[model samples]
Target chain A: MNWALTLWRLASFAVAAGLIALWQLIANLKLVSPVFLPGPDRAWAALMRGFSNGTLLDKTIGTLEHMFYGWLVASVVGIALGAMIGSSRAMRSYVAPSLEFLRPLPVSAIIPVAIALFGLTQGMALFVIAFGAIWPMLLATVHGFGAVEPRLYEVARSLHMSRLAVIFKIALPSASPDIISGMRLSLTVSLILAVVCEILAGLDGLGHWVLLSARAFRSADLFAGVILLGVIGYVTALAMSMIEQRLLRWRTSGH
Target chain B: MTSIALRKDIPSAELEKSQIAFSHVTLDLGGKTIIENVSLDVKPGEFLCIIGASGCGKTTALRLAAGLYQPTSGHVSFDGEPMRAPRRDVAIVFQDYGKALLPWRTAAGNVALALETIGMPKAQRPARIDELLKKVGLPNHAAKYPAEMSGGMQQRLQIARCLAQEPKALLMDEPFGALDAMTRQGLQDEVLSLLDASKATVIFVTHDLEEAIYLGDRVVGLLPHPGRIGIDLPINLPRPRDQLTTRENPEFLRLRRELFDFIKASEA
Candidate 1:
């Protein structure tokens, strides 16, 4: 009887499981053609086969590598530019209009430009991912830096702390929470851009595999790839949340 | 022993001279004059309080004393030299304690900011931090962050951080204004004992008339609309003043009545 409370905590996953069971029941009754819509068992079998044959592992690694490089480059450039622009009113005013003009251009729209510049290679994929991820990180960092309490600046100045020390200690730490949230947003964006670039370029990644399977009429393989991508997205987001919690333990650990 | 021997080499009369002096200082902010030709003298080891209404520019004057702002016309000096910028020897305690201390840093980490600015060796900081926290009656609260402490405790931590600088003069801008009555009285007595032991010159700004009389060797009443001194009264209340007894003293009552009348008339 006490297990009722425990089952309530697992309600989300239990609902997902129930939906999958219903899907299997409908497919078994042939309510729709299995050719167009296969049961969960077909997708699971395809997933297991792909993993055992090492194709899924290789493609996942390729996707992860592309995402990491692009995220890293974006983070470095975003943080540096954000700090400079946010700290100076003149710089912010000068660059803000140009950034605003370009920010609304969609990532899919930029694919042709990226393809022309770097071709269908890893470089092309990196360019696409970095281009897509940088905006959120840069805006978040600028806002974070701008929102620092003015009194903290006075405290540092009155103490006669050196210029570099003030920036590193007070400015950076004060802006970190906002900056971390921005990075989390950029992480999900990077995952999305990586897959999109992979599909557009026909490169070696989950996106390319999913596309190829769908074209060849292997619905189970396409479904399996989609499920794998979902898991990867969920796990990476979970990892980012862990890092954020660790960094912001000071805020949440006590009153 | 070395410092004592070194101190004896300088003339004691030079040490006893006015530590901070504002000579006809006028400050203009955004095309409007905020402080107009105000002159004041803070002698060595003196406790002077500036009491005024909200628009009287008392906080601006305190900032000037801290060398965080420079006068438009005359000179604000320390050790007879004009102050150009904030010096390590002059520390400031602000009223908004929540914004002043770093939220991410623990109480000890906040105090360590002053010590680090002075470039004390890393190995020597822990003991000095413990001593400073103990002095502020916050020995056990060292690991607690500013958000975790009450207003009074956070203010005490701020005071401890300022003390870490070992400044020759302190500029406090209504430090106890945010605390409750009992907490304010306790902190006032603690500040008196701390100043007594250190012999540091202090310029305490407050809107509270009784606080000005209770704490200051002299109370400078400022008139609003471009702040300037209106009444300069010496408080002859005895040392080691008690909260109940000092408030009940005749001279204290007299000074309070005078400052109260001055504030009322300045607003009118």
Candidate 2:
């Protein structure tokens, strides 16, 4: 379509390719061991091997499934709890201290406890990821619900809306933009947690794939796994942006 | 005492007054009184606009009348019953239209919201929504979300939505204040025309003196902190009044000037 944008994209790709070429040259000259700097071609072959053998793909799906479940659990629970706490002064005061205390405790810090309690099971992994992801989302949902225009609530009242009708029709939609923003933030955190859990907890995921390759000195596979995780992370984040665009299209154009 | 007297005088007036009311309406936000010793006698099929400076609690007065807030001292009765929460016979069009609508729904979906709120049958809502869309000149924009709309169009949809409740009265809080000049006047005319067609009792709140004068069958000026009636000015202009002539007319100009001087005097 637009030549300027097309050319810029092409140039950026070329620059990326050039950087890879330089890495290949350094590895070939023995400037660095292949253990640390496997060339792109070698990495490509390893990626093919993993894909052909189905190990990489399987781990990828496992990682995604964890991300999916973790994000879902966290988002749903966070939104509901956040709304409850945010709307009620009593609930907010009761829960605010605990949430503030726990939100800062790193996901890594909790893994040992999770492992000891749940013993490296899916439950442990899901809990760790969900725990971290839910915090930001819960706060967002609370704020979103709190920020709902009072006038709209009056609209519900004047229309003689049932309590459920007001919540579903007015309250949820009113607070959705802020809540979605929270979910977007939480999703990245969830993905990061999934990978960290896979690596430290010996779980079935891409993080484990990377760790295994590195220990065995399978340099190419290790590099491929890291690169694959990067792509997945980038795509996942972009997908969230697209979803927000579609969902809040009303807010965008309204007078 | 007066309420009982009025009710007995007119057999249908309670049903008429059940449309909306405010009496000795004292409102306390936290512990501070916002509206006090306020009273109004509104009939069905009439338009009343409240005008005042910011923080005057003119809006609060409407809220009290709508049963959005409980008066600290006086009682607000709707249709001869003590007002509680919001009623289905009255609908509000907010100053901030964006805040009123759901971001996920289309214009018609937003309009259909009120009907759904009142538990209208689902099977019949679509046709009602379509009728509203056509009435508001948004027949083709039913599926268009609020975000896709221009300010005037969004307000139009809001008006249509308020009407969908088939309310006996409409409550608006500076609904056109945020629009550009051209759009504001256009919406004002459109709103007036719609009110004329429906004969729906309307309680519109605005800070604009011109808008208050132009739209109201009577303009009630209010003062702040403890909101009280500053002036109760009536417009006796003939029906289906024109904007240009009415604005330039001697009676309209005199009332506008008197109200303008009244606010200035109050501030002084």
Candidate 3:
């Protein structure tokens, strides 16, 4: 690897270290009770302990399963809806009001309704998160697809390209960047929704773990869970965006 | 597939009868008329270039000829039959250097996409693709994607792809407009050579008046804003045009000046 890139990575680590040091110094100086404000070391130790027994791994996998499923379902449905909205003026005009109304309401805001319907189950959390995450994807898809060159569409028609060929080869790749961007933004929202549902409903996921630890004065475990969730969210976003970049190689077709 | 052994000697009269005709065509875009009562007649193998300013409806008229768009008034017909949609026998080369090309496909594969679109036999496509690539002077670039190639290379590939369809008539929308001077000169020669070799009638649209004069048997100029035929001039320039000789010729200068005067008047 180039030294510049290596240095950038090191710098990022250094920033994280500085933040941890500051937090630890503040807690130690009695800025907050040790019972409530755990040092980074204590959180790290709790993280290692949780991983050593696979309890953290199990809960992480559980949360991840819900997240991926919700993401997949929402992405598929959202893309379809968005394409339709983009292509047809009538659908866009008709569907605009309802989608606008539904999108602004927080995923957590729908938790009571989800619990009432699915009784605090994984389905309930997944539904809330997926529904929440879908708007960004739909909006992005509509905009991205709408923005594809009209000349390109006419070319497709003149070439007698089949509907499937046009969608897969033309529409999807063209719209992918915006779609992935929306999805990247959605992943964070999904995590927030998942955590909110887990904590408020006392469901068996990361947020539930954080709540349990914090309630029992296990501040280290609570911080550890929070940090793990952050890492998961960040890593997933990075990977998806990388895929977006690769597929959009054509967009950079210039010297 | 070339079956040289079994080819019968078809008469020129019979071939000339199968011509492309645009009959008093007027095109409308969003309630704004572009082509106003424009008529064109092309004999088989004729290279006709439509020259005009930007937004002069050169492209609109070409689209009508290609049957991509229907005339809001009058009609574009092929051998007396009104064009319903894109004809199976015609191919178009867009100016955006095949930005319309499916990105997933290789240069050969982009050509092959038309084959696939028409549901041609899978076995015949590769050989045809190779022949076309060779014809377009891009045999080695066949495996490359449009994104990988230079603008000129991409245009060559697109032309090669159009050739693979074995079109009876070619409609090109200023295919070299995006290229630099040297590359544009090279591709123009390639296009001329291809036209010389094939019997395909061509209706090329270009904003470049010199280009219109250089390649066309007849150059039709359209004026912008309710685009109508401003001038239609026939060129008697000899085949295998010598770049230096043709550009320096007094006759060529006279034709260009006349075209410029017409265009200037149109702009005014």
State the C-alpha lDDT per candidate.
0.88, 0.82, 0.82
Tens-place lDDT digits, model 2, residues A146-232:
888786776777777777677777777778898889999988998899999898889999999999989999889999899888888
Lowest summed lDDT over 10 consecutive residues: which window, candidate 3 chain B? B1-10
- Each candidate's fnat, listed in order, reads 0.63, 0.92, 0.33
Candidate with the larger TM-score of 1 and 2: 1
- For candidate 2, the per-residue lDDT at A226 reads 90
How far residue A201's Cα lies from its native spot in candidate 2, in Å, is 3.7
Best by DockQ: 1
lDDT per residue as tens, model 1, B51-143: 988999999999999988999999999999989998888989999999999989999999999999999999999999999999889999999
Quote the lDDT for B136 in model 1: 87
Candidate 2 at B219: error in angstroms? Answer: 3.8
Per-candidate TM equals: 0.93, 0.87, 0.88
Candidates, DockQ = 0.65, 0.54, 0.31
Model 3 agreement with the true structure over A18-97: per-residue lDDT tens digits: 99899989877979999898888789999999999999988888778777888888888999999888877899899999
Question: Which candidate leads the pack in lDDT?
Answer: 1
What TM-score should be assigned to candidate 3?
0.88
lDDT score for residue A206 of model 2: 94
